[model samples]
Target: MILPNSGLMIPWLQSKLDTARYVTAGDLGGEMVADSRKAAVLIPLVLHSSGSTVLFTERAAHLSTHAGQVSFPGGAYEVQDLDLVATALRETHEEVGISPARIKVMGCLAEYFTFSRFRVTPVVGVLQPGFELVPDSNEVADVFELPLDVVLDSRRFERKMVERNGQRGFTYFLEYDGRVVWGATAGMLLMLAKSLE
Candidate 1:
Protein backbone atom coordinates (compact mmCIF):
# COMPACT_ATOMS: atom_id res chain seq x y z
CA MET A 1 0.00 0.00 0.00
CA ILE A 2 1.23 3.49 -0.90
CA LEU A 3 0.83 5.63 2.20
CA PRO A 4 1.41 9.38 2.49
CA ASN A 5 3.98 11.11 4.61
CA SER A 6 2.86 13.27 7.54
CA GLY A 7 2.92 16.58 5.72
CA LEU A 8 0.98 15.31 2.73
CA MET A 9 -1.52 13.18 4.60
CA ILE A 10 -4.14 15.83 5.31
CA PRO A 11 -5.40 16.34 1.81
CA TRP A 12 -4.66 12.83 0.65
CA LEU A 13 -6.52 11.19 3.50
CA GLN A 14 -9.23 13.81 3.52
CA SER A 15 -10.07 13.11 -0.07
CA LYS A 16 -9.72 9.38 0.34
CA LEU A 17 -11.81 8.87 3.43
CA ASP A 18 -14.30 11.56 2.50
CA THR A 19 -14.86 10.14 -0.97
CA ALA A 20 -13.92 6.47 -0.97
CA ARG A 21 -16.39 3.63 -0.99
CA TYR A 22 -16.43 2.36 2.59
CA VAL A 23 -18.34 0.04 4.92
CA THR A 24 -18.79 0.14 8.69
CA ALA A 25 -19.07 -2.68 11.22
CA GLY A 26 -22.79 -2.12 11.31
CA ASP A 27 -22.84 -2.95 7.63
CA LEU A 28 -21.16 -6.27 8.46
CA GLY A 29 -24.09 -7.29 10.67
CA GLY A 30 -23.99 -6.77 14.42
CA GLU A 31 -26.78 -7.28 16.96
CA MET A 32 -27.18 -3.80 18.41
CA VAL A 33 -28.76 -2.99 21.75
CA ALA A 34 -32.09 -1.25 22.09
CA ASP A 35 -32.28 2.55 21.66
CA SER A 36 -28.61 2.65 20.74
CA ARG A 37 -26.40 5.31 22.32
CA LYS A 38 -24.89 7.71 19.79
CA ALA A 39 -21.17 8.32 20.02
CA ALA A 40 -18.04 9.16 18.02
CA VAL A 41 -14.27 8.55 18.09
CA LEU A 42 -11.35 10.57 16.81
CA ILE A 43 -8.85 8.68 14.67
CA PRO A 44 -6.08 11.21 15.24
CA LEU A 45 -3.20 10.68 12.81
CA VAL A 46 0.00 12.33 13.95
CA LEU A 47 2.37 13.41 11.21
CA HIS A 48 6.13 13.23 11.50
CA SER A 49 9.19 13.18 9.26
CA SER A 50 9.56 9.42 9.64
CA GLY A 51 5.93 8.52 8.91
CA SER A 52 2.43 8.78 10.37
CA THR A 53 0.73 7.14 13.34
CA VAL A 54 -2.78 6.89 14.73
CA LEU A 55 -3.21 7.92 18.37
CA PHE A 56 -5.00 5.57 20.75
CA THR A 57 -5.89 5.68 24.42
CA GLU A 58 -6.11 2.95 27.05
CA ARG A 59 -9.34 3.43 28.95
CA ALA A 60 -8.92 3.77 32.70
CA ALA A 61 -9.44 0.46 34.49
CA HIS A 62 -11.77 2.09 36.98
CA LEU A 63 -14.24 3.01 34.29
CA SER A 64 -17.49 1.08 34.25
CA THR A 65 -17.23 0.16 30.58
CA HIS A 66 -14.45 -0.69 28.15
CA ALA A 67 -11.89 -0.44 30.86
CA GLY A 68 -8.28 -1.26 29.87
CA GLN A 69 -9.24 -1.39 26.21
CA VAL A 70 -7.31 0.51 23.55
CA SER A 71 -9.37 2.96 21.60
CA PHE A 72 -9.44 6.35 19.94
CA PRO A 73 -10.04 9.48 22.05
CA GLY A 74 -13.81 9.89 22.11
CA GLY A 75 -17.07 9.17 23.85
CA ALA A 76 -20.82 9.50 23.77
CA TYR A 77 -22.33 12.65 22.28
CA GLU A 78 -23.30 15.33 24.75
CA VAL A 79 -26.42 17.41 24.46
CA GLN A 80 -24.27 20.54 24.12
CA ASP A 81 -22.50 19.19 21.05
CA LEU A 82 -23.80 20.05 17.62
CA ASP A 83 -23.06 16.70 16.02
CA LEU A 84 -21.05 13.52 16.27
CA VAL A 85 -18.06 15.35 14.77
CA ALA A 86 -18.15 17.86 17.60
CA THR A 87 -18.51 15.00 20.04
CA ALA A 88 -15.32 13.47 18.66
CA LEU A 89 -13.35 16.70 18.72
CA ARG A 90 -14.51 17.70 22.17
CA GLU A 91 -13.90 14.26 23.62
CA THR A 92 -10.46 14.09 22.03
CA HIS A 93 -9.44 17.29 23.72
CA GLU A 94 -11.04 16.32 27.02
CA GLU A 95 -9.50 12.85 27.04
CA VAL A 96 -6.06 13.61 25.57
CA GLY A 97 -5.61 17.40 25.66
CA ILE A 98 -4.96 17.81 21.96
CA SER A 99 -6.79 20.98 21.06
CA PRO A 100 -8.87 21.31 17.93
CA ALA A 101 -6.45 23.94 16.60
CA ARG A 102 -3.66 21.37 16.33
CA ILE A 103 -5.76 19.01 14.28
CA LYS A 104 -7.05 19.33 10.78
CA VAL A 105 -10.29 17.39 10.55
CA MET A 106 -10.26 15.29 7.40
CA GLY A 107 -13.48 13.35 7.25
CA CYS A 108 -15.51 10.65 8.94
CA LEU A 109 -16.23 6.93 8.52
CA ALA A 110 -19.56 5.20 8.47
CA GLU A 111 -20.94 4.63 11.99
CA TYR A 112 -20.18 1.32 13.74
CA PHE A 113 -22.92 -0.13 15.92
CA THR A 114 -21.95 -2.36 18.83
CA PHE A 115 -23.75 -4.77 21.12
CA SER A 116 -22.94 -2.30 23.88
CA ARG A 117 -25.50 -0.02 22.25
CA PHE A 118 -23.19 2.64 20.79
CA ARG A 119 -23.49 3.84 17.22
CA VAL A 120 -19.91 5.14 16.93
CA THR A 121 -18.87 7.40 14.12
CA PRO A 122 -15.14 7.48 13.52
CA VAL A 123 -13.87 11.01 12.86
CA VAL A 124 -10.56 11.21 10.99
CA GLY A 125 -8.08 14.01 11.63
CA VAL A 126 -4.44 14.78 10.91
CA LEU A 127 -2.50 16.11 13.88
CA GLN A 128 0.09 18.66 12.94
CA PRO A 129 3.55 18.01 14.29
CA GLY A 130 4.13 19.06 17.93
CA PHE A 131 0.72 18.13 19.27
CA GLU A 132 0.91 17.21 22.94
CA LEU A 133 -1.04 14.77 25.11
CA VAL A 134 -2.22 15.19 28.72
CA PRO A 135 -4.64 12.37 29.35
CA ASP A 136 -7.49 12.62 31.85
CA SER A 137 -6.80 9.96 34.47
CA ASN A 138 -10.46 9.42 35.17
CA GLU A 139 -11.20 8.31 31.63
CA VAL A 140 -7.83 7.36 30.16
CA ALA A 141 -5.17 5.14 31.66
CA ASP A 142 -2.48 5.82 29.03
CA VAL A 143 -1.93 7.10 25.53
CA PHE A 144 -0.04 5.45 22.70
CA GLU A 145 0.58 5.68 19.02
CA LEU A 146 0.01 2.97 16.41
CA PRO A 147 2.08 3.29 13.27
CA LEU A 148 -0.07 4.04 10.27
CA ASP A 149 2.07 1.67 8.26
CA VAL A 150 1.30 -1.20 10.61
CA VAL A 151 -2.29 -0.13 11.16
CA LEU A 152 -3.15 0.19 7.49
CA ASP A 153 -1.45 -3.08 6.65
CA SER A 154 -3.88 -5.91 5.98
CA ARG A 155 -1.78 -8.55 7.69
CA ARG A 156 -1.96 -6.88 11.09
CA PHE A 157 -5.69 -7.41 11.62
CA GLU A 158 -7.65 -10.64 11.79
CA ARG A 159 -11.35 -11.29 11.30
CA LYS A 160 -13.25 -13.44 13.80
CA MET A 161 -16.82 -14.18 14.63
CA VAL A 162 -18.05 -12.31 17.71
CA GLU A 163 -20.05 -14.92 19.57
CA ARG A 164 -21.97 -12.83 22.11
CA ASN A 165 -24.19 -15.75 23.10
CA GLY A 166 -27.43 -14.97 21.26
CA GLN A 167 -25.80 -11.94 19.60
CA ARG A 168 -23.39 -13.04 16.88
CA GLY A 169 -21.54 -11.22 14.13
CA PHE A 170 -18.05 -10.42 12.82
CA THR A 171 -15.39 -8.16 14.29
CA TYR A 172 -11.67 -7.53 13.79
CA PHE A 173 -8.77 -7.63 16.22
CA LEU A 174 -5.23 -6.27 16.11
CA GLU A 175 -2.95 -6.97 19.01
CA TYR A 176 -0.40 -4.40 20.16
CA ASP A 177 1.59 -4.02 23.36
CA GLY A 178 -0.20 -7.08 24.84
CA ARG A 179 -3.64 -5.41 24.77
CA VAL A 180 -6.44 -6.49 22.43
CA VAL A 181 -8.05 -4.01 20.05
CA TRP A 182 -11.40 -5.47 19.12
CA GLY A 183 -15.16 -4.96 18.94
CA ALA A 184 -16.50 -1.55 17.91
CA THR A 185 -13.18 0.25 18.37
CA ALA A 186 -11.13 -2.14 16.29
CA GLY A 187 -13.98 -2.43 13.85
CA MET A 188 -13.72 1.31 13.20
CA LEU A 189 -10.00 0.94 12.57
CA LEU A 190 -10.69 -1.96 10.25
CA MET A 191 -13.07 0.19 8.24
CA LEU A 192 -10.43 2.90 7.88
CA ALA A 193 -7.74 0.40 6.96
CA LYS A 194 -9.93 -1.25 4.37
CA SER A 195 -10.99 2.10 2.96
CA LEU A 196 -7.37 2.91 2.24
CA GLU A 197 -7.05 -0.31 0.28
Candidate 2:
Protein backbone atom coordinates (compact mmCIF):
# COMPACT_ATOMS: atom_id res chain seq x y z
CA MET A 1 0.00 0.00 0.00
CA ILE A 2 1.17 3.48 -0.83
CA LEU A 3 1.40 6.08 1.95
CA PRO A 4 0.91 9.80 1.70
CA ASN A 5 3.96 11.63 0.46
CA SER A 6 5.17 15.06 1.64
CA GLY A 7 3.41 17.31 -0.89
CA LEU A 8 0.17 15.31 -0.87
CA MET A 9 -0.36 14.48 2.81
CA ILE A 10 -3.05 17.03 3.62
CA PRO A 11 -5.45 16.15 0.83
CA TRP A 12 -4.53 12.49 1.01
CA LEU A 13 -5.40 12.24 4.71
CA GLN A 14 -8.59 14.20 4.32
CA SER A 15 -9.80 11.96 1.54
CA LYS A 16 -8.82 8.79 3.36
CA LEU A 17 -10.58 9.74 6.60
CA ASP A 18 -13.59 11.08 4.78
CA THR A 19 -14.35 7.70 3.24
CA ALA A 20 -12.80 5.28 5.72
CA ARG A 21 -14.78 3.14 8.11
CA TYR A 22 -14.16 4.37 11.62
CA VAL A 23 -12.71 1.98 14.20
CA THR A 24 -15.16 1.96 17.07
CA ALA A 25 -14.56 0.46 20.51
CA GLY A 26 -15.87 -2.99 19.65
CA ASP A 27 -13.73 -3.16 16.55
CA LEU A 28 -10.71 -2.88 18.78
CA GLY A 29 -11.98 -5.75 20.94
CA GLY A 30 -13.31 -3.55 23.74
CA GLU A 31 -16.46 -1.79 24.78
CA MET A 32 -17.08 1.66 26.13
CA VAL A 33 -17.52 1.81 29.86
CA ALA A 34 -20.72 3.08 31.33
CA ASP A 35 -20.72 6.81 32.04
CA SER A 36 -17.36 7.30 30.40
CA ARG A 37 -15.95 10.84 30.50
CA LYS A 38 -15.26 12.65 27.22
CA ALA A 39 -11.72 13.47 26.13
CA ALA A 40 -9.91 14.63 22.97
CA VAL A 41 -6.37 14.39 21.65
CA LEU A 42 -4.54 16.19 18.86
CA ILE A 43 -2.70 13.92 16.41
CA PRO A 44 -0.28 16.57 15.26
CA LEU A 45 1.47 15.97 11.91
CA VAL A 46 4.25 18.16 10.62
CA LEU A 47 5.71 18.61 7.14
CA HIS A 48 9.48 18.55 6.76
CA SER A 49 12.00 18.48 3.94
CA SER A 50 12.53 14.77 4.35
CA GLY A 51 8.89 13.88 4.96
CA SER A 52 5.97 14.24 7.35
CA THR A 53 6.23 13.37 11.02
CA VAL A 54 3.84 13.02 13.95
CA LEU A 55 4.43 14.59 17.35
CA PHE A 56 3.97 12.66 20.59
CA THR A 57 4.42 13.62 24.20
CA GLU A 58 5.79 11.67 27.14
CA ARG A 59 3.42 12.30 30.03
CA ALA A 60 5.09 13.53 33.20
CA ALA A 61 6.02 10.68 35.50
CA HIS A 62 4.58 12.57 38.44
CA LEU A 63 1.04 12.56 37.08
CA SER A 64 -1.42 10.27 38.73
CA THR A 65 -2.91 8.66 35.60
CA HIS A 66 -1.10 7.22 32.58
CA ALA A 67 2.11 8.66 33.92
CA GLY A 68 5.26 8.25 31.77
CA GLN A 69 3.19 6.95 28.85
CA VAL A 70 3.75 8.08 25.30
CA SER A 71 0.62 9.79 24.10
CA PHE A 72 -0.90 12.44 21.94
CA PRO A 73 -1.37 15.83 23.55
CA GLY A 74 -4.82 16.01 25.08
CA GLY A 75 -7.01 15.80 28.16
CA ALA A 76 -10.54 15.37 29.42
CA TYR A 77 -13.16 17.75 28.09
CA GLU A 78 -13.76 20.96 29.99
CA VAL A 79 -17.06 22.78 30.42
CA GLN A 80 -15.84 25.92 28.65
CA ASP A 81 -14.35 24.08 25.67
CA LEU A 82 -16.41 24.68 22.52
CA ASP A 83 -16.29 21.08 21.32
CA LEU A 84 -14.09 18.02 20.97
CA VAL A 85 -11.93 19.86 18.45
CA ALA A 86 -11.56 22.78 20.80
CA THR A 87 -10.72 20.45 23.64
CA ALA A 88 -8.01 18.84 21.53
CA LEU A 89 -6.43 22.12 20.43
CA ARG A 90 -6.60 23.58 23.91
CA GLU A 91 -5.01 20.62 25.61
CA THR A 92 -2.35 20.34 22.91
CA HIS A 93 -1.33 23.96 23.42
CA GLU A 94 -1.34 23.55 27.18
CA GLU A 95 0.73 20.38 27.11
CA VAL A 96 3.24 21.03 24.31
CA GLY A 97 3.02 24.80 23.73
CA ILE A 98 1.99 24.50 20.06
CA SER A 99 -0.33 27.35 19.21
CA PRO A 100 -3.73 26.44 17.76
CA ALA A 101 -3.20 28.86 14.91
CA ARG A 102 -0.33 26.81 13.56
CA ILE A 103 -2.28 23.60 13.09
CA LYS A 104 -4.77 22.94 10.30
CA VAL A 105 -7.26 20.36 11.51
CA MET A 106 -7.99 17.80 8.80
CA GLY A 107 -10.60 15.70 10.52
CA CYS A 108 -11.35 13.48 13.52
CA LEU A 109 -10.96 9.74 13.86
CA ALA A 110 -13.54 7.58 15.60
CA GLU A 111 -13.73 7.70 19.36
CA TYR A 112 -11.41 5.24 21.15
CA PHE A 113 -12.56 4.18 24.61
CA THR A 114 -9.94 3.57 27.26
CA PHE A 115 -9.89 1.25 30.27
CA SER A 116 -9.80 4.35 32.44
CA ARG A 117 -13.37 5.16 31.36
CA PHE A 118 -12.36 8.05 29.13
CA ARG A 119 -13.74 8.29 25.58
CA VAL A 120 -11.07 9.89 23.39
CA THR A 121 -11.54 11.65 20.06
CA PRO A 122 -8.40 11.77 17.98
CA VAL A 123 -8.26 14.97 15.95
CA VAL A 124 -5.84 14.93 13.03
CA GLY A 125 -4.06 18.21 12.32
CA VAL A 126 -1.14 19.31 10.16
CA LEU A 127 1.35 21.82 11.51
CA GLN A 128 2.92 24.66 9.64
CA PRO A 129 6.70 24.74 9.50
CA GLY A 130 9.08 26.54 11.88
CA PHE A 131 7.12 25.92 15.09
CA GLU A 132 9.01 25.35 18.33
CA LEU A 133 7.90 23.38 21.37
CA VAL A 134 7.83 24.35 25.05
CA PRO A 135 6.28 21.36 26.78
CA ASP A 136 4.78 22.05 30.19
CA SER A 137 6.91 20.37 32.80
CA ASN A 138 3.92 19.58 34.96
CA GLU A 139 2.10 17.52 32.34
CA VAL A 140 4.71 16.66 29.73
CA ALA A 141 8.09 15.13 30.46
CA ASP A 142 9.42 15.10 26.87
CA VAL A 143 8.41 15.60 23.24
CA PHE A 144 9.42 13.55 20.20
CA GLU A 145 8.62 13.06 16.54
CA LEU A 146 7.99 9.92 14.49
CA PRO A 147 7.97 9.72 10.75
CA LEU A 148 4.45 9.63 9.37
CA ASP A 149 5.53 7.08 6.79
CA VAL A 150 6.93 4.81 9.46
CA VAL A 151 3.74 5.08 11.42
CA LEU A 152 1.45 4.47 8.46
CA ASP A 153 3.35 1.33 7.57
CA SER A 154 1.27 -1.46 9.10
CA ARG A 155 4.20 -3.89 9.16
CA ARG A 156 5.92 -1.87 11.86
CA PHE A 157 3.23 -2.65 14.43
CA GLU A 158 3.01 -5.80 16.52
CA ARG A 159 -0.10 -7.41 17.96
CA LYS A 160 0.25 -8.74 21.49
CA MET A 161 -1.95 -10.35 24.10
CA VAL A 162 -2.23 -8.69 27.49
CA GLU A 163 -4.37 -8.72 30.60
CA ARG A 164 -6.14 -5.66 31.91
CA ASN A 165 -8.42 -5.65 34.93
CA GLY A 166 -8.27 -9.47 35.06
CA GLN A 167 -9.36 -9.88 31.43
CA ARG A 168 -7.02 -10.88 28.64
CA GLY A 169 -7.18 -9.22 25.21
CA PHE A 170 -5.11 -8.25 22.19
CA THR A 171 -3.54 -4.86 21.67
CA TYR A 172 -1.36 -3.10 19.12
CA PHE A 173 2.06 -1.62 19.85
CA LEU A 174 4.74 0.34 17.99
CA GLU A 175 8.20 1.24 19.21
CA TYR A 176 10.40 4.06 17.92
CA ASP A 177 13.74 5.28 19.20
CA GLY A 178 13.21 3.49 22.55
CA ARG A 179 9.75 4.95 23.15
CA VAL A 180 6.81 2.59 22.97
CA VAL A 181 3.39 3.75 21.79
CA TRP A 182 0.61 1.39 22.75
CA GLY A 183 -2.95 1.08 24.00
CA ALA A 184 -5.37 3.65 22.63
CA THR A 185 -2.56 5.63 21.02
CA ALA A 186 -1.33 2.69 18.96
CA GLY A 187 -4.88 1.69 18.16
CA MET A 188 -5.52 5.11 16.70
CA LEU A 189 -2.38 4.85 14.57
CA LEU A 190 -3.44 1.44 13.36
CA MET A 191 -6.82 2.84 12.43
CA LEU A 192 -5.14 5.48 10.31
CA ALA A 193 -2.83 2.94 8.80
CA LYS A 194 -5.72 0.77 7.71
CA SER A 195 -7.34 3.78 6.07
CA LEU A 196 -4.49 4.08 3.60
CA GLU A 197 -5.19 0.62 2.26
Candidate 3:
Protein backbone atom coordinates (compact mmCIF):
# COMPACT_ATOMS: atom_id res chain seq x y z
CA MET A 1 0.00 0.00 0.00
CA ILE A 2 1.21 3.48 -0.87
CA LEU A 3 1.64 5.89 2.02
CA PRO A 4 -0.47 9.05 1.92
CA ASN A 5 2.30 11.39 3.09
CA SER A 6 4.67 11.83 0.21
CA GLY A 7 6.94 14.54 1.58
CA LEU A 8 8.00 15.74 5.02
CA MET A 9 8.12 19.36 6.04
CA ILE A 10 11.13 20.82 7.83
CA PRO A 11 9.09 21.46 10.95
CA TRP A 12 7.90 17.86 11.13
CA LEU A 13 11.42 16.57 10.64
CA GLN A 14 12.72 19.01 13.22
CA SER A 15 10.26 17.76 15.77
CA LYS A 16 11.33 14.16 15.30
CA LEU A 17 14.99 15.04 15.35
CA ASP A 18 14.68 17.19 18.44
CA THR A 19 13.19 14.33 20.40
CA ALA A 20 15.58 11.68 19.05
CA ARG A 21 17.40 9.56 21.61
CA TYR A 22 21.08 9.96 20.88
CA VAL A 23 23.29 6.90 21.27
CA THR A 24 27.05 6.76 21.11
CA ALA A 25 29.55 4.02 20.45
CA GLY A 26 29.64 2.01 23.67
CA ASP A 27 32.56 1.89 26.03
CA LEU A 28 35.58 0.42 24.33
CA GLY A 29 37.70 0.54 27.52
CA GLY A 30 39.22 3.86 26.63
CA GLU A 31 38.88 7.26 28.32
CA MET A 32 36.21 8.25 25.72
CA VAL A 33 37.88 11.55 24.98
CA ALA A 34 36.87 13.84 27.80
CA ASP A 35 38.41 16.82 26.02
CA SER A 36 37.73 15.47 22.59
CA ARG A 37 38.25 17.37 19.35
CA LYS A 38 34.89 18.67 18.18
CA ALA A 39 33.59 17.72 14.74
CA ALA A 40 30.28 17.59 12.86
CA VAL A 41 28.71 15.60 10.05
CA LEU A 42 25.67 16.17 7.90
CA ILE A 43 23.20 13.36 7.40
CA PRO A 44 22.03 14.60 4.01
CA LEU A 45 18.42 13.57 3.44
CA VAL A 46 17.29 13.83 -0.16
CA LEU A 47 13.68 13.85 -1.22
CA HIS A 48 12.32 11.63 -4.00
CA SER A 49 9.03 10.24 -5.32
CA SER A 50 9.45 6.93 -3.54
CA GLY A 51 10.75 8.42 -0.32
CA SER A 52 13.95 9.90 1.11
CA THR A 53 17.52 8.76 0.57
CA VAL A 54 20.73 9.42 2.53
CA LEU A 55 23.98 10.67 1.04
CA PHE A 56 27.32 9.19 2.09
CA THR A 57 30.89 9.47 0.88
CA GLU A 58 34.00 7.35 0.72
CA ARG A 59 37.18 9.08 1.77
CA ALA A 60 39.96 9.28 -0.79
CA ALA A 61 42.40 6.37 -0.52
CA HIS A 62 45.33 8.77 -0.38
CA LEU A 63 44.04 10.53 2.71
CA SER A 64 46.12 9.85 5.81
CA THR A 65 43.16 9.17 8.06
CA HIS A 66 40.34 6.71 7.50
CA ALA A 67 41.21 6.47 3.85
CA GLY A 68 38.65 4.67 1.68
CA GLN A 69 36.19 4.39 4.56
CA VAL A 70 32.57 5.36 4.00
CA SER A 71 31.40 8.34 6.01
CA PHE A 72 29.12 11.35 5.87
CA PRO A 73 30.45 14.67 4.52
CA GLY A 74 31.88 16.51 7.49
CA GLY A 75 35.05 17.54 9.35
CA ALA A 76 36.64 19.26 12.33
CA TYR A 77 35.26 22.51 13.71
CA GLU A 78 37.10 25.65 12.64
CA VAL A 79 37.32 28.89 14.52
CA GLN A 80 35.67 30.68 11.63
CA ASP A 81 32.60 28.44 11.79
CA LEU A 82 29.67 30.04 13.55
CA ASP A 83 28.64 26.76 15.20
CA LEU A 84 28.67 23.01 14.84
CA VAL A 85 25.80 23.18 12.36
CA ALA A 86 27.75 25.67 10.28
CA THR A 87 30.81 23.44 10.47
CA ALA A 88 28.79 20.50 9.17
CA LEU A 89 27.33 22.55 6.31
CA ARG A 90 30.72 24.01 5.38
CA GLU A 91 32.39 20.62 5.32
CA THR A 92 29.55 19.07 3.35
CA HIS A 93 29.82 21.85 0.81
CA GLU A 94 33.59 21.51 0.62
CA GLU A 95 33.66 17.74 0.34
CA VAL A 96 30.53 17.13 -1.79
CA GLY A 97 29.84 20.49 -3.45
CA ILE A 98 26.28 20.65 -2.09
CA SER A 99 25.75 24.31 -1.34
CA PRO A 100 24.24 25.40 1.96
CA ALA A 101 21.53 27.36 0.17
CA ARG A 102 20.06 24.15 -1.21
CA ILE A 103 19.83 22.57 2.25
CA LYS A 104 17.29 22.97 5.03
CA VAL A 105 18.60 22.13 8.48
CA MET A 106 15.89 20.02 10.10
CA GLY A 107 17.46 18.84 13.36
CA CYS A 108 20.40 16.98 14.87
CA LEU A 109 21.21 13.66 16.52
CA ALA A 110 23.09 12.98 19.73
CA GLU A 111 26.79 13.60 19.90
CA TYR A 112 28.90 10.51 19.28
CA PHE A 113 32.41 9.76 20.52
CA THR A 114 34.66 7.87 18.16
CA PHE A 115 37.47 5.52 19.04
CA SER A 116 39.52 7.41 16.48
CA ARG A 117 39.43 10.24 19.04
CA PHE A 118 36.88 12.89 18.16
CA ARG A 119 33.50 14.04 19.45
CA VAL A 120 31.18 14.17 16.46
CA THR A 121 27.80 15.82 16.22
CA PRO A 122 25.40 14.50 13.59
CA VAL A 123 23.38 17.24 11.97
CA VAL A 124 20.22 16.33 10.09
CA GLY A 125 19.41 18.32 6.97
CA VAL A 126 17.20 17.90 3.92
CA LEU A 127 18.73 18.41 0.52
CA GLN A 128 16.47 19.97 -2.06
CA PRO A 129 15.60 17.86 -5.07
CA GLY A 130 18.07 17.76 -7.98
CA PHE A 131 21.28 18.84 -6.25
CA GLU A 132 24.28 17.41 -8.07
CA LEU A 133 27.09 15.87 -6.05
CA VAL A 134 30.61 17.00 -6.85
CA PRO A 135 33.11 14.97 -4.85
CA ASP A 136 36.41 16.57 -4.00
CA SER A 137 39.42 14.61 -5.21
CA ASN A 138 41.44 15.26 -2.06
CA GLU A 139 38.67 14.43 0.39
CA VAL A 140 36.06 12.17 -1.16
CA ALA A 141 36.77 9.21 -3.39
CA ASP A 142 33.13 8.57 -4.26
CA VAL A 143 29.66 9.84 -3.44
CA PHE A 144 26.66 7.51 -3.23
CA GLU A 145 23.11 7.40 -1.97
CA LEU A 146 21.41 4.77 0.19
CA PRO A 147 17.72 4.21 0.66
CA LEU A 148 16.61 5.63 3.98
CA ASP A 149 14.39 2.59 4.46
CA VAL A 150 17.40 0.30 4.27
CA VAL A 151 19.34 2.29 6.79
CA LEU A 152 16.37 2.60 9.10
CA ASP A 153 15.52 -1.06 9.32
CA SER A 154 16.66 -2.68 12.57
CA ARG A 155 16.41 -6.14 11.07
CA ARG A 156 18.98 -5.30 8.40
CA PHE A 157 21.76 -4.72 10.93
CA GLU A 158 23.83 -7.05 13.07
CA ARG A 159 26.03 -6.65 16.11
CA LYS A 160 29.61 -7.81 15.74
CA MET A 161 32.26 -8.15 18.39
CA VAL A 162 35.27 -5.93 17.74
CA GLU A 163 38.64 -5.37 19.38
CA ARG A 164 40.97 -2.42 19.04
CA ASN A 165 44.35 -2.61 20.79
CA GLY A 166 42.84 -5.13 23.21
CA GLN A 167 39.76 -3.07 23.98
CA ARG A 168 36.80 -5.21 23.06
CA GLY A 169 33.13 -4.37 22.54
CA PHE A 170 30.22 -4.90 20.20
CA THR A 171 29.42 -2.58 17.32
CA TYR A 172 26.58 -2.36 14.85
CA PHE A 173 27.33 -2.81 11.16
CA LEU A 174 25.40 -2.97 7.92
CA GLU A 175 26.96 -4.45 4.82
CA TYR A 176 26.10 -2.93 1.45
CA ASP A 177 27.56 -4.13 -1.78
CA GLY A 178 31.06 -4.99 -0.35
CA ARG A 179 31.35 -1.91 1.78
CA VAL A 180 31.09 -1.78 5.57
CA VAL A 181 29.41 0.93 7.58
CA TRP A 182 30.65 0.40 11.13
CA GLY A 183 32.01 2.18 14.19
CA ALA A 184 30.94 5.72 14.93
CA THR A 185 29.35 6.19 11.52
CA ALA A 186 27.02 3.29 12.11
CA GLY A 187 26.32 4.49 15.61
CA MET A 188 25.27 7.90 14.35
CA LEU A 189 23.13 6.37 11.63
CA LEU A 190 21.47 4.21 14.25
CA MET A 191 20.45 7.33 16.09
CA LEU A 192 19.01 8.80 12.90
CA ALA A 193 17.06 5.67 12.13
CA LYS A 194 15.64 5.54 15.63
CA SER A 195 14.83 9.24 15.52
CA LEU A 196 12.92 8.87 12.29
CA GLU A 197 10.81 6.15 13.88
TM-scores vs. true structure, each candidate: 0.91, 0.93, 0.88
Instruction: Give the runs in model 1 whose Cα sits over 4 Å from its true position.
Output: 27-33, 163-166
Say which prediction, candidate 1 or candidate 2, comes out ahead on lDDT. 2
Residue-by-residue lDDT tens digits, candidate 3, 1-197: 12123365456677777776766543352236666798999999887777777889999999987888889999999999999999999999999999999988887776787766688888988876789788899999999888777777767788888876466777788897677887667777777777767
Give every collision pair in model 3. none
* Candidate topping TM-score: 2
Tens-digit lDDT string for candidate 2 (1-197): 66656788788878887898886752237587778899999999898767888999999999988899899999999999999999999999999899999999998988888777788888999996799798999999999999888887778889888766566678888987788998878888877777656
* Residue 16 shift from truth in candidate 1, angstroms: 1.1
Going through the candidates in the order shown, the clash numbers are 0, 0, 0
Better of 1 and 3 by TM-score: 1
Among residues 3 or more apart in sequence or in different chains, the pairs in candidate 2 whose N, CA or C atoms overlap within 3 Å are none
Which one is best on lDDT? 2
| Local distance difference test, each candidate | 0.82, 0.85, 0.79
**Each prediction's RMSD to truth:** 2.0, 1.7, 2.6
What's the ranking of the predictions by lDDT, best on top? 2, 1, 3
Give candidate 3 misplaced runs (Cα > 4 Å): 1-6, 9-11, 23-31
- Name the candidate, 1 or 2, with the larger TM-score value: 2
